[model samples]
Target: MPSQITRQITRHVLTIPAQGGKPARKVHYRRCGQGPALLMVHQSPRSSSEYTELMRDWAAHFTCIAPDTPGFGQSDPLPGEPEINDFADAILEFADALGIAPCAAYGFHSGGIILVTAIKRRPQAFRCLAVGGYAIWTPEEMRIFGESYLPEFVPQPYGEHLAWIWSRILEQSWVFPWFDTREEARMSIAHADVEHVARTVSEMLDAGEHYRAGYGAVLRAPRDIPAPDAVVPPCLISAYDGDPLQAHIDRLGAMPASWSAQKVATPKEHQDLSLAFLKEHADTAPCGALPEDGHEGWLELEGGLIHWKGAKGGRLRLHRPAEELADPSKGEIAIDVPGHGQSDDFDDMKRAVEASAEALGVSDIDWPAPPAGDADRLYPDMAPDRFGLYLQRAWQVARAEAFFAPWYEANAAHAVPLTPEAIATPAVHARALARIRAGAAARRWHDTLAQIQGETA
Candidate 1:
């Protein structure tokens, strides 16, 4: 047996074919390890980021591939109100794009719903599946969830949505549906950890209003598993105590002979069982060549992996702190500077930028103009507070910057002229998310640019 070896997870963008009226779009994915491909799908409102640690460990046994489902993470959304099949077919397109068909697979929660549908649609595409907590919702359960589960998540002018979502994701573990605070709704295992809640909140913020579509599609989907007599891939379905979907294991009465459901004592036990099941049934053949991003990818340099897009040399455009690459498709080479966007952190951002330009064979650095205000007041570091107030802070900062040039001075004297579109919800949401995600390093980027510009001047 090959000893477990750690592999660095690499991200790539695969273009899925256009469907319905929607145009073709990029699907961001993470890959690790080397062996037969094992496709993993994540639950709703969360991206493939959930599989990072698992991918690292599983890398020893299989080539793990996980993609951000549409409208989640960096992947784009499908047009209109897409149903279960649309998402299932999208998964197929994703797998086909990589030429990794008939691969071993795993999915959790909403992910289980998607992969189950995909396997049923084309059994030959997968060799086996390991599902975590499959749901077989009763009509009454569906009706109850339908009424209160997915509230339209619109961004509010006063940061009301920020507060609402933070609390909602935080309380999700406290109660089954999160919204229902009644004692009957409480879960056996509950946690109020700031770190865990913050991560879920961040992913939720990333999904935005599109979360409803992905989540609703799964909640309303019919029994995702195929009939007992149907030919399908070898599979194992399991759930642990405290999981809401564990009860649904009993609901899955008649399944294919190759598929079996098990109740585990703990999450670790469930994962352990799934891993063993996958190892036993995993395909022996190695995965084929994977598609690569034409315009955007990570560039390894002195500092860290800097995410760059477009052909180099028109100009090396740099977005200032509290922001990321403005427009990647604007006929200019743009990079998510160190500690910003998708780029990894580096202490000396100036050196990082210089190294990037040198590698890209570009001399022109089109740096963004500096903000006109006290740096201290303008940049708050936007740390995650225990109550998650930092979310609202970032939101307000994004809004404030739009209305006032410095964002600290509330008076009309500092007011900047901008149209309603400039401060629109989507626009501000992007800005706020940037700030929340990378605002801590904004100062380093700002200082780096300032020094470079000062020397040039």
Candidate 2:
């Protein structure tokens, strides 16, 4: 294991009046490194805290600045739910307020959506952009997500909600694997751990009703950034298999020549790859090389040792403070998936799985058998080829028993009042069943069985 990097940095909180009656604002930002400026925009339901570690590393090369977007973390909410354009303008204003001209910007997920919009609106403000997992949902996909926006899976008694939320995210890969390659997809799934998944789910739900509202705003917004063809700066859009944005890669693939696209397995790898590309291609350059630190953590599935400080959260220890990550060692890098450590919301589950797998060197491998006792009895007659599957199923059963059972029992008292027309409705139940069947069919159980047989042989 390599030693982690230790660096000192400063954080500043500025209250910039919103442009044109939007509202007053208090923005907390961290400044580090020396040289060209780099602004990192975090995704929705999260704060500037997401990039603490990455910023320390990147600051070594450029002055890295990360801010909490409006309506997230400590930043004041936008006046009445601003659109993507509002976010773009807010970022532009943030730049001007900080006196950072012609700075390079990077955004992940919804943050990417906002930055791309900003670049299109004011091309001169940014010199380059690196976007991760940009979501461009198809019409039908949007419809499904809109309907399922407030999933009833919020865990009861709070504690179980953690595991419940984690399972919901883990089950998502069965629906979509957005990477450009199988290796990327496999590596991405291998890095998640139960604790990380639980924490992220808990945070998103804790954000109160605003969580659903924020999601609704994005879902109601237009599909593409209003100006897809505006060529202001060199842009790189990257995605991995488990990334929800992976489905939208085709949309980005159609971007004008100024933009480029690639897929990597993990978030840390994506950041490193993007930084290396920027160092080579982007005119704005980093200042100097920084030394490594002594942080160490296990990547759950991938079985690799990741070195960094603030291991519990997303903070990275660096030799010097900078605005963004400097060059890192080649190969996959681990990041805390959302809701765990410093990341916010349930979306971090995908990244966590990938990071854990990478740390543990367990990519594409089956999980060990369930421990002795009740766990063993629960699945005595069933077998799963992948460790994730077993864990996912166990979580689902535990959650259903823990949360839904009491609700169902209590509701029975009102069962007589429940009209025949009101009980979940046959059509809804049918659709749900159909979705389940389709999911099972699409999972290609036979393929997994074949792989298991091959391994045994």
Each candidate structure's TM-score, on Cα atoms with residue i matched to residue i, is: 0.94, 0.54
Query: What lDDT score goes with residue 377 in model 2?
Result: 26
lDDT per model vs. reference: 0.86, 0.52
TM-score of 2: 0.54
Question: Which 10-residue window in model 1 sums to the lowest lDDT?
Answer: 1-10
Q: For residue 42, what is the lDDT in candidate 1?
A: 99
Deviating ranges (above 4 Å) for candidate 2:
1-6, 150-192, 198-206, 225-229, 265-268, 280-457
lDDT of 1 by residue, 108-159 (tens): 9999999999988899999899999999988998999999999999888778
| Winner by TM-score | 1
What local lDDT does model 2 show for residue 437?
Answer: 20
Give the number of colliding residue pairs in candidate 2: 51
* 310-370 per-residue lDDT for model 2 (tens digits): 3333322221100111333333233323222222223233344445544444343222221
Looking at model 2, which ten-residue stretch has the lowest summed lDDT?
A: 316-325
